[model samples]
Target chain A: MMVAEAQINNNTINLLEGWEEGLDKAPEWVQSFRKKAADDVMKTGLPTPAWEDWKYTNLRNLESVTLCEASSLHVVPNISSPFIDLKPIIVQLFNGSFVGEMPDLPDGLMIAPINEVWTNDWFKGFVSSLSIDTPMEALNSAFLNDGIVIKVSENTKIAEPLLLLSTYENSKDMLSVMPRIVIILENNAELNIVEHQSGIGSYVCNQATSINLGEKSKLGHYILQDNDRTQGYLFNTTKLNCYDDAVYDGFSLNHGAKLSRHEIFADLLGERIECIINGAYNLISTQHHDTTIKTGHFSPNSISKQIYKGVINHEASAVFQGRICVHNDAQGTDGHQLNRTLLLSEKAEFNAKPELKIYADDVKCSHGVTSGDLNDEELFYLRSRGIPEIEAKQILTKAFVAEVIEGIKDSVVRDIFLSISIEEGTK
Target chain B: MRAQLGRKKESNYKMIKIKDLHASIDGKEVLKGLSLEIPKGEVHAIMGPNGSGKSTLSYVLSGKEGYEITSGSISFDGHDVTNMMPEERAALGMFLAFQYPVEIPGVTTINFLRTAINSLRKARGEEEMDAISFLKLQKARTAELGVTMDMLKRGLNVGFSGGEKKRNEVLQLVMLEPRFAVLDETDSGLDIDALKVVSKGINSLRSAERSFLVITHYQRLLDYIKPDVVHVLADGVIQKTGGAELALELEKHGYAEFEKNQSNGAVA
Candidate 1:
């Protein structure tokens, strides 16, 4: 334990020194946030391996790298093949800084940087409600720079999704970019948001996004991370705050990156709120992917459902840890979580831990996990019908992954996800 | 486009010939040197009692797992194909209608059939079937089998009843058009109506280019799909080989004498 503490302190000192030198080109507000973030990083160093949440995903290698500042801002970006053609309220971030091109504004949708409203009393109070217990979340708040802030007016519905694209170009040196975003939906409003993270070369990305839904509001959010093989480390922290009768649906699909971690936390504060979380990950060849989700039902009569699936091939590894907590006061809560994994190679590995901690006696909660290969009887049946071995395996794998993809409401995005998943499964 | 190659002389010869075949599953010997021959342009029925190794012969011929060939060989179209992968045997135009078909969740019937047909076509050096043409052919075949388009849209054998699953097997047989088919207890769980529908589909595919080995425990299905020869499979061996009247004899007298004879012979 002492050794782990010492290593974390050393990493914090290295990061602070790098931040002090890297903030010269950043904005004034960003520089201020960095100073506070560096202080917090020192106070809360690295998470230990014994930590229950980080037990399956090791961060030893990520802490040792002396990441530099962003140096690829001058390079031209290839912006072709944007996912959707609609004129959404687009906010493009290039290496943690806001770009100039903005889309046409919608009637009830407002898009701006979080710093623009940081001084406002109402927004400041709301930002204070965010959980800063974890070091990663604290670091994101301390280094808070230019992340998009979306606001949906009360009783309004936006047909087009709000698109946020975070792009990382190849830097001349080893660099790390921390992008933080916050979203708020007013009472009785409906909105959809998609966060797309992509990069061209090796770089470390640390992203934090917070969503607060007002009373009776509905929010659908999708996170897609598809970077190049050269991209090294990714840490994403997403939190949600739900009110009475509010609905939150989120789906995450991860396809690339050498090492990636997605951590989600949801706090259901009001009665009768509904939340659904679905995710799928496809890993191949030395890639390490991790997804950790936790939901706390603080109020009575709240409901939550989660399903996460993974397909690991070659020497890749994936980890899924899901936990649901129903407090003593949270009676009549209903929750379920299921995690399944398919191992395609002998060397490939998968670790799944789904936990349900219910202190309320009147709650109904259950969790299950399974890991195995394709069934032999099913394989023989297909072969007896004239399907070859390789094609049979491919077909079975595609069907396994389709369970998660079927939840996507958008047809175009669903098609793209299916095609990419099949291609990866066949390969 | 590649032209269809000339049909080889072996295609005209008797397609499936079994001679003194001995097999077992889980160390329990099932087929005790059972011998039967299915010549081209003819369909033969094998009627037997329970634990008669009728299904064992079908599994051994198609190369199913856990069934070891202790002795003898199975020749298909002049080629020794006793030891081949299930897909390899299928690609060589050998089809087996399982008595209890396995359900493959999430794989649509249309998609599976298209893949199977294209794989066989590709193996024969023939042009691949396009999507439109394949759909047109599938619709005609499913209609002839009395299966609706909705059944084909669902997962293979998922939520299907006993008769529906048997009809699904026949649907594939018609679509694939295999040279030699082994129906392993295909009529075990079917009612009169389903049996007639299944037999009608089977009879429609009868031709000089194809042969069938129908394995059943009842003589009722044989009444509909008439057989050229009837063989009694008792104690893993062909106890009696006679005309179609042999089925009536077994249906009436049962296999008491056959079992006694095999037990006495075992003691010697």
Candidate 2:
């Protein structure tokens, strides 16, 4: 008992108190990875406000919740998706474990559990190559129990999007879940994926996804985190690698969760590649959100663009930290980033740190950050047209986020996002 | 040539009455002790130089913020709207055609018009216009206003040319069918062809129940939509009132004569 108390004191906050025993059931390779991750986490613990990247987000709510590992969840909970009407193939991941049978697939497409694919050479190589940049990522790696792996063969084009719907619900003991997603597209392949995450109770969900796009490949990745607004805490890490002539267009919509931190790291590995990342979030009450991005331009003639817009109301606060690094060999690289937020209440706050580290002289890179209340001119214009004041504000707020949603290339996906954004942003 | 053939004479019923209108912006008085009246069925023009409070009067009448009425009252169609909100004033049939129409991105012009029309209808306890009926009315109004349907597809006044913006305002005036409209420098940026199209659209809305206050620096617009009375506004007050010929006279002599007379009268 004395040693346990001393260990807790040394680790600051030990989330592995009740969740460490079940991790032994994972495979040998994952067991080793988990061993190393556990050691690293014991040394570092979770992110705190002292960390520069987490300055504005405090984990006070997470420390009080007693989290335990979820048992083998075989019973499929009846669940519906936000895009259920679109009829896409829905793959469910309950309590960080992929459940249910694999849906029908077209030619050259593969989907399997990570436990089944851990022996594959490419899967081993990919898992070993992951860099743990933060304690949350280490926690995800440490407790890596069950996940999914999706691969697209060369020259394959998917007709319909695949929805990876992850749901976590615990009414009893608060659960901590870790889910990993690995996606790889061969040369000249194309795919669209919509990742939706949600939960019910005060659970801690830490998820990581690794994506690799081969030469001339195209991917449209959309993510929506609509967890329980008053309870859940989510930490997401997305690492992307792009080859020559590949395009990775990604957008995230965050309007849920009591606290969320979404970190993205994109590595431009090959020439003439294009990476576009855009996001829009609406936070109300005491909700807090953070988006931290790091894009490395390593090749010549690559382009990267990031645009984020959010509306913060009530006592909610949001943080945006975006950094673009252009290496010496990355000549002719074009990078742009912009973050604009609208504050609906005087107590609402937005903190932004936009940085550009360029060693290439010929690169064209710029960033901008703006935050303010709704434009009085815009509000007055709408009211002058006989719309009531409250309705006028709603219209302007909806319009503020319309640009990000409408920029989506796929019409169906665009419509879904547009409806959600309009609904949440106006409210 | 002034088009006086369709001009309506002033009636006994006053549609709008501005009494001793002393207003200010940013604590600096702009319209001091100014008074004007426009009876039903008649169109009145208020011509003034830059900073003569013509725009202030229009904004104040339309209930825009930042303009405080020090001590005056504005009544439109028998409703005292001094403390009313902008939308409330709009519901009372008061409209101001801005000199610079604001650009609202992401909202299509057609959507804006529909919302405005439906809001007005709802405010008056009428059922909102159905979509099909709105489209039909929009088709007729666009045709009458000489505005292309393509312009309505884009964001409201976003990327629109100066002429297109003025025409859109005129299109809105026709759509809303307000009882009182203030054309604030509606002809400032319009070229010859657009000026004629916008004036023709405004002329089509002229009725015995409607009134207008045309505020302009030049008399070019009065040539197309003839006003029954033209008032010379200088130094925050109306100095003279005359027939349609007054506009042509101001156009020829300019506000220089009015400024000189006002300064001379101030010295006395």
Candidate 3:
């Protein structure tokens, strides 16, 4: 017992003490990954504002928040999506466990818990190959138990989108859940995955998703984070590996959560590939939101563009970090990134960092960062036209950030973005 | 050549009455105890040299930024408009055709016009106009001005040529249909053809219930849209008042005489 206590850090020990138990039924291979992740957390620690990557954000409750692995799950409450309701296949999970039977899926598609599908060599290699770097990601891998496994067979295109809602609620006053999601699209397969989270408890939900797109595959990924933010915290990570001719388009609408960190990593591994990552966030009333992105161009003729806008008001603060790295052999690569922020009050703050590293002379890569309050001339002009002060501000702020929503190609998704604007922002 | 006319005989049918006006911008006095009165349905032109407070008077009337009226009483129609906001003044039928129209990105001119019209209508508790009717009205208003559909589709004043911007301002004036409009140097950057187009647009809006205050440095525009009264403003006061013939007189004699008189008066 003393040696085990010495092996893992005090933080991980506290993480394993509550909920009356810890990780129960994960396999030997999974256990090995979990153990390594815990030891790594002991060696390094939580991120602080001093860290270069976390220069503007701090994880204050890493040691104090009462977090225990969700060893047991309760009932699965019924919930429906607010957008894209075309009778699509639905999978529901409760408190980090797959609690209900899956609905009928399209041909050549399968959905199951990770334990039931780990026999596939590719699946095992992918799960075992993941290495955790940060504290939250390490926590995700260590206590991770139940999550969805999606497999889309080669050459099949699903017309309708697939929905996955991970709902967290229980009688417990505090809970910590690590829900892992793995999506595998075979060669030339196409699919749209819509993932959402909602809950009504003090739960720290650390969610992670890994995507493996085979040659010529296409994936449209969207995340809806509309949880009970007053009593919950959410940390999310999405990793992408794209093959030849693959296209990965991702958009996230962030409107809730007390403290949320969404980090996305994309690696363009094959020739003639593209990746588009765009999102918008509205932080209100002391809420804090941070989005960190890192995309690498390793092969020739690959393109990646990142655009994100944020509106912060009422003592709230936000941070956005975007970085693009191009290798020497990626001569024909093109990378573009931009982050624009609007502060609606004197107490509101926003920070942005855009980094570009290019070793190849033939590559074209650029990044821009800007943060400001509303323009006075624009305000006066609109108000002078008899528009009320409130509405004049809404029109100006909405126009300042509407370009990101217009970037969406799907009509339904675009409408959904318009409906959730983080409140025209009260000063 | 026509005989000159002075300020119309004092009448009870007044549109704008300014008494004991003293205004400043950035702590520098511009308008010092200036006063004027414009009767309804009249087009009065104000002629002054550079830094003579011609633009300041226009801005003070329109409720623009950076101008403070330290002591003044400006009555529009019947309401005391000295404390009204810019939007409030706009709702009360006041419009300022900017000399340098601000360039706003991402807002199209069509959308701006619709928003402005609807705001005014909503203030008056009138129903907002539908898109079909708005487009129809816009087509009729902009048809004779030679404004293309492309100009209306672009961002407000963004990438527009100087003449195009002035024409756009006139286009707004026609759409708003205000009771008292201030055209501040609207003729500064226009060529002869564009000037005629702009003047025609403004002229089309002239009605017996409407009044206009046209401020200009030259008399060229008066030839196109004749004014009822012409006032030579110097030292923040009207030093001479006459008819449209006064504009022709100033064009021939220049503002040298007015400057010389003001200097001599100061020395005395």
Candidate 4:
């Protein structure tokens, strides 16, 4: 195999300047962690297309774009309430920094800046135990300045969902904002959280979210990224760890960002755990989005599922990479994955790769992938019913992605995702 | 021998007329210069064996693509619609009850009906119906058809049985209230009960200004939906025409005679 030595190029180094100021006031361990991440970045550059996993994406695109660090000036936009009827605890983040007054959270729940919890033993241990897998994640850890930490005490079932609304705006030449979030739910706890990212100006939002679910806990996680398509890039990574009898349900809707990649890694470390990762993307106008997920079943009687669907229009492209690994001890594991995409134009493209590594003989695993245009029979049926050609196409396209959104277990959240998908798919 | 009829003077009563309509699919001719005419306020039934181009005729009438007209014209309500789209034909008060209703997995049946109704209204320059009004109308039309309100909430014909699909089509027919309709084997998979419900829906819409072309393979449906005329289609052309008795005769004797005559290139 021809090996291309991964080295940080000068252009990438130029983007990493002015990082010391952000880390000067951080705790000693945090500073060392950032320094080690920066050293790794200098030794091994950002991922190039030469890597097998990133063969379809090229980091060189970020080199030409002048992405300076986000300014200290806090320019908060007039944001609107979420389009859901259920009253949620709203937390707004401007340019990756937590802004606005903190709401009165319910008892047994805490939401604070990440730095505020840095001194706590559990939070410190969690931060120190993170092992960087990709160069992009290393870049995030190296320059991370602002983020929030959410924790739910044991046996606490929060009635309202927590909405993390992050908005970004670049006043100067393209800006880069790296935000990290950590969520911990103790035993027998349940909580629902949604993160929405939207902004106007050109910027790169490189963010990461790590979730730890204790035994008998349930967490419903949702990410809706509807950033400006022409002026932004998003790289979001989610790392999840589930203990015995823990359930991690996650869904993502991506219709924004000129280019984006949402990668997820879930570790079912204890028995009887359930992990569901589902998402839908509607892209148009030369936009690109990638969804990569890896689930490791280390314990028996665990279940994992991944369902992703996309609609690619006008020269837009998308990628879906799903990898499921069942260890020898993970007997009685049930894993299923499916990916489907609709290419609306001749120039639209979709690439799917499904990898399954099974070492357990008693496990049940299945994966499927399909990519095509709309069905002619279905289209003709709608048109014959007096629906115009254009409207018929839109209806069918929305229905195509709506099938995936239906996998969302929550009805209110499903409707919110459906409305956003309908609005975006029509475009 | 062609069943010839006397030509009538052009009047205000709109009719569907096909003149030497020839259509082909994939370079093979399926409708070979077929011609038929149905005046207003009449129900005509066409019976044929398999591969006799009955379905092709229905598709051609609704302006489905991939079927080259080759050399012919189709006109409805004094308007030339040979080159029009399926939706255009629908806007002109034309409807087709498909033999097999398509299953749209995520679009609910009620939403589909509302969209169709609103689109037709827009095309006709009329006011669109709101949700409440549309629901009231739908409830009224579907009340006696044995279609429960729960079916409307489900996806369009997604997991419906054969009878349910046919009932849904009849429901659409009643809701749309088109001036011209072509029922393409609507009785193919339905049982006796569904046939009556469908027939009732069709009979309710019969008026002096509306016409229908019912395409069927069996005579069972004709017992419920009485037709004014019956035509025998064979080898892509109409071979014979008679009164309602013709459907009974075809059912009793089978399509053997028609098939024999079709091979001989005979028209009666």
C-alpha lDDT of all candidate models, in order = 0.79, 0.85, 0.80, 0.86
- lDDT per residue as tens, model 4, A42-108: 7777777777888887667777778676765554556764544558998889888888888999998
**What would the per-residue lDDT of candidate 3 be over residues A1-30, giving only the tens digit for each residue?**
002112233445555443223335656676
- How displaced is residue B165 in candidate 1, in Å? 2.4
For model 1, residues A56-82, the per-residue Cα lDDT tens digits are: 777777666766777546443555434
* Chain B structural similarity (TM-score) per candidate: 0.91, 0.93, 0.92, 0.93
TM-score of structure candidate 3 = 0.85
Off by over 4 Å in 2: A1-13, A18-22, A71-82, A421-427, B1-11, B261-268
Candidate 1 Cα errors over 4 Å, as ranges: A1-10, A13-37, A72-76, A79-82, A85-91, A229-231, A410-412, A423-427, B1-12, B259-268
DockQ of 3: 0.51
- What does candidate 2's lDDT look like per residue over A1-427, in tens digits? 0011112222235466544565666667777888898777777666666667777888766667777666567877777666775688778889788888889998888998888888778888888887877777777787775789989999999887989888888888777778899899999999999887778887878888889999999999988777777788888899899999999989888886888999999999999999999998888888899999999999999999999999999998999999999999999999999999999999998999999999999989999999998888888888887999999998888888877877777789887877774445212
TM-score of chain A of 4: 0.96
The model with the greater lDDT, 1 or 2, is: 2
i-RMS, each model, one decimal: 1.2, 0.8, 1.4, 0.6
lDDT per residue (tens digit) for residues B91-201 in model 2: 878898989899988788998999999999999999999999999999999998778888998888999999999999999999999999999999989999889899989
Per-model tally of clashing residue pairs? 0, 0, 0, 2
Docking class of 3: medium
Per-candidate TM-score against the hidden true structure: 0.89, 0.95, 0.85, 0.96
Q: Between the candidate structures 3 and 4, which one is better when assessed by lDDT?
A: 4
Candidate 4 ranges beyond 4 A from true positions: A1-4, A421-427, B1-14, B261-268
As for candidate 2, its clashing pairs are: none
